[model samples]
Target: MSEASLLKTQVVTLRVPNELKSRLEQQAKSQGVSLNNLANYLLTTQLSQLETLSGIEQRLRGRNLNDLKQKIAFLLNKVPHNPDLPEWDRL
Candidate 1:
């Protein structure tokens, strides 16, 4: 494991509705990760995505479709086109 993954974590309590909690538990089981892992991943990734979209919205507030397409293509190009997935990441 990486040092970052080894860092200490604190427990947090949330009072989610029963339905939401059940859904999250089901999703975590389907994804082969503990509920804690799934919750942590969802919270961290969703926040980052929300922040990214906020910045993109401000930048492209008055932009046209072509501008949006170009920005999307530029961002997509940054990802490597690798098909191989490590065993831990395979689902």
Candidate 2:
């Protein structure tokens, strides 16, 4: 990533329900962190979790495909080479 692509601090206005805003402020105060910092921390944590989950999903998909192939090969090996019944059409 380039510095130019990085996000620099920018101010934006947001309107939240009064109760929610108060709750956030209270939580921030209790945690001894500014509301902005707390929000940023939460977002960063969630983003990291999402990245981790994505990697896990990719691994699971690869495993599933491999298992399917193995099952198909096993079934093919079990198929009967010769039928026990005589051919009715030839009679």
What C-alpha RMSD separates each model from the true structure?
Answer: 9.1, 16.4
lDDT of 1: 0.92
After superposition, candidate 2 runs with Cα above 4 Å error: 1-7, 12-16, 65-91
* Backbone Cα, N, C clashes tallied per candidate: 0, 0
The alpha-carbon deviation from the true structure for residue 17 of candidate 1, after best TM-score superposition, in angstroms, is 0.3
The C-alpha lDDT values of all candidates are: 0.92, 0.84
lDDT of 1 by residue, 1-91 (tens): 9998879788889999999999999999999999999999999999999999999989978879898799989998887766687877643
Model 2, residue 7: distance off in Å is 7.9
Candidate 1 positional error at 68, Å: 8.1
Which structure among the candidates has the greatest TM-score? 1
